[model samples]
Target: MPIRTTETTVTLDHPFALTSFDSVLPAGVYRLEIDEEEISGLSFSAYRRISARLHTPAIGVLSSIREALPIDTRELEEVLKADRTPIILPAGE
Candidate 1:
């Protein structure tokens, strides 16, 4: 018999911290939950792969911010929630 599958995909205009999904998921192996999850035994492999690619750029921006200005996490969070895409840059240039 063939296995039945269901898939969900959410593409954000801006990248979100992995924590964003915490509210929706319980700690378990979830497959077929995301379109990327369909890629074999590693259910979240695709998401991880994509995140790795984005990490470098994101980190560069974060580092730049730390160098240039005093950052407030609460204020940043409020701004981020309002904007679909917020710029994150490393402290220097």
Candidate 2:
């Protein structure tokens, strides 16, 4: 089976907690890794998510070690939607 791994980062402005973590995480940039497997028997190529992992302690932190935690992608998306900073555009045409 062919599996594809995707890596990305998420940023939160305020402290947030995740079900997979024991404590609240500080606001900063966090790395998210997702794995998806290609599905067969289809006319078009498609992939389904297999798993998602979040890197602990945020990026650029002075931690000796980092832990990859298994997380629910939907939950993470909700958290991000609630925690994301809104961008304001200048008044101009």
Best by TM-score: 2
Clashes of 2: 0
Residues 1-93 of candidate 1 have per-residue lDDT tens digits of 123333422233443343323222222211112111224566553322111111122221333322212223344355347455567898896
Tell me which residue pairs clash in candidate 1: 61-89, 61-90, 63-90, 63-91, 64-90, 64-91, 65-90, 65-91, 67-91
Q: Give the lDDT of residue 25 in candidate 2.
A: 94
Which stretches of model 1 miss by more than 4 angstroms? Answer: 1-67, 85-93
Q: How high is each candidate's TM-score?
A: 0.20, 0.87
lDDT (CA) per prediction: 0.31, 0.93
For model 2, residues 1-93, the per-residue Cα lDDT tens digits are 699999999998998998999999999999999999999889999999999999988999999879999999999999999887576788892
Look at candidate 1 and tell me the lDDT of residue 7.
41
Q: Candidate 2: TM-score?
A: 0.87
Q: Please provide the root mean square deviation of candidate 1 (C-alpha atoms, Å).
A: 16.0
What's each prediction's clash count? 9, 0
